[model samples]
Target: MNIKLWIDKGFEILLDYGPKLIMAFLIWVIGNFVIKLITKGLKSAMKKAKYDISLSKFLSDLLNWSLKILLIIVVLSTVGIETTSFAAILAAAGLAIGLALQGSLGNFAGGVLIMIFKPFKVDDLIEAQGELGIVKEISIFTTKLRGLSNKEIIIPNGSLSNGNIINYNTEGTRRVDLTFGVSYDSDIKETKSILMSVLINHPLVLNDPEPTVNVSELADSSVNFAVRPWCKADDYWTVYFDITENTKIALDKADIEIPYPHQVEIHKQN
Candidate 1:
């Protein structure tokens, strides 16, 4: 008699919950399929919009997880579970996490803006946040740069996006500003001619802009001539060092003296 009662009780419980369980299972499967289709469509849209690869992947993953969580809540509700409390719990947890990672979220938002607006790209020479370097990688939270000294620099995207960004590659050419001081007695015209010749003779210097040599200042000990040369962006440092050395040689060959301080000693004989 007890065995029969136990069997009846088992059947009664199954009858009460069997349809709900089946409905929940069906919802789970269908929801997953729809979520996948939605994610696939989103990816296709992003690709059409030419979104950055990292950003596309990150967004797709985020959407996928968020949808999955919603689907879980729906399935639980279908199984006769209270999902309002569950959703509230999720919302509270999300708020806490968001508060905890406020800075990171800011950086993530900045990175998204960067990827969308594209102020700079990988391999471009940029100066931002008091650092100058070639953009190495652009991630979701930070930007990596290969510094001029070959050091790897990581900067938070939040600050980088907010700060001023100078992209040197945009113009394809850069002006090399230099100053050469000559003896006070040196003829200004002669000094300017010599400096212009040095700039014109250099192979790397651009000729269209026409290098400039001007008397910038007359100091107590010497006269300063500003020498500005234009060159390809990549050849900046090379042209700078070459022009400096070549100017010294050319001035020395021309008998133009660069002034130096001299100290005369007075000897007393007892």
Candidate 2:
């Protein structure tokens, strides 16, 4: 008798919940498929809008998760769960999560600001947080950089957004400024002429604005000349290094002496 009673109760429960369970399953399947389509469309729209890759990815993920949550709520409600109770639980959980993830939230917000303002983009050489590098990628919370030494650097967007950023590639043309010192024995006019000739003859150097090589300072050991030459931003580094080394070689060929520090001691007779 007891076994029969248990069997009857089980059958009644299954009957009561069977349709609801099936409906919930259907909703889940259809909702998930719809979400996929929506996210795909969102990605396409973002691409058409020319949105930043990092920002677009973040937004898509956010939307997908949010929609899935809503779909789950609807499925639960269909299975006889109370919507009000579910909402209250969600509210409390969200509060707890927000408190626990303050820093991540701040970073996310900063990333949004960066995407909007666009201080730096991928491939731009920038200086921030006392580090200089080319931007490799910008992510939801972190930005990646390729350092001059080829090391990968990851920085939090929160700090990056708050700190000062020096974007070296914003201007199409960059001025390569170099300072070289010649020995005091060298004639200033001849040294200047040599420096100017080096700059003028360089094919990469822009001639429209002209290059300036002038005597900037008279130090104890040497006379310093400031060499300023303008070149396309993409050629700045190449020009910088080439001009510096070439100037030395040119000066050597011209017999101009580059100054270096030396110490002299006179032996006193006892």
Candidate 3:
């Protein structure tokens, strides 16, 4: 008689919960399919919008997990479990995590802004936050740069996005500003001519804009000529160094003196 009673109880429990269990299982499977479809559609949209690869992947993953969590809550409720409290707990936990990672969150938002706006991109030369470098990689929270000295520099995206950014490659060319000082007695016309020649002879210097040489300052000891040269962005440094070296050589060959301080001593006889 006890065995029969136990068997009846088992059947009663199964009858009570079987449909709910089956419904919850169906919901889970269908929710996952819908979530996948949503994620795939979002990825397609982001791709059409030309979003950064890293940003697209990150956002897709974020959406996937959030949807999975919501689906879990729905399945739990379908299985006769109260989920209002579960959602509330999740909200509270999310709030706590947000508070703890406030700075990181800001950086993540900044990175999203950067990827959307495209202020700079990988391999582009940029100056921001007093650091100049080629953009190496752009991540969700930080930007990596290959510094001029070949050092790797990592900058938090929050600060980088907020700060002033100077993108050198936008115009495809750069002006190299240089100043050369010659002795006060040097002929201004001759000095300008020599400087102009140095610019024209350099292979990297651009000629369309026409390089310029003008007297910028007349100091006590020397006359300063501002020499401006235009070159392809990638050739800026090469042109700058070459012009400087060539100017010195050309000036020396022409017998023009670069002034230097001289100390004269007079012997006193007692």
Best by TM-score: 3
Model 2 spans > 4 angstroms off: 1-41, 52-54, 71-81
lDDT of 2 by residue, 14-93 (tens): 99999999999999999999999999999999899766787898899999999999999999999998899888989999
Q: What is the TM-score of candidate 1?
A: 0.88
List candidate 3 stretches off by more than 4 Å.
Answer: 48-50, 264-270
lDDT of model 1 at position 77: 88
Candidate 3's residue-wise lDDT over 123-211, tens digit each?
A: 99999999999999999999999998999999999999999999999989999999989998899999899889999999899997889
**lDDT of each prediction vs. the true structure?**
0.94, 0.92, 0.94
Per-candidate TM equals: 0.88, 0.81, 0.92
lDDT of 3: 0.94
| Local error of candidate 1 at residue 92 (angstroms) | 1.5
CA RMSD (A), model 2: 3.9
Candidate scoring better on lDDT of 1 and 2: 1
- Clashes counted in candidate 2 amount to 0
Worst 10 residues of 1 by lDDT: 49-58
Would you list the rank order by TM-score, best first? 3, 1, 2
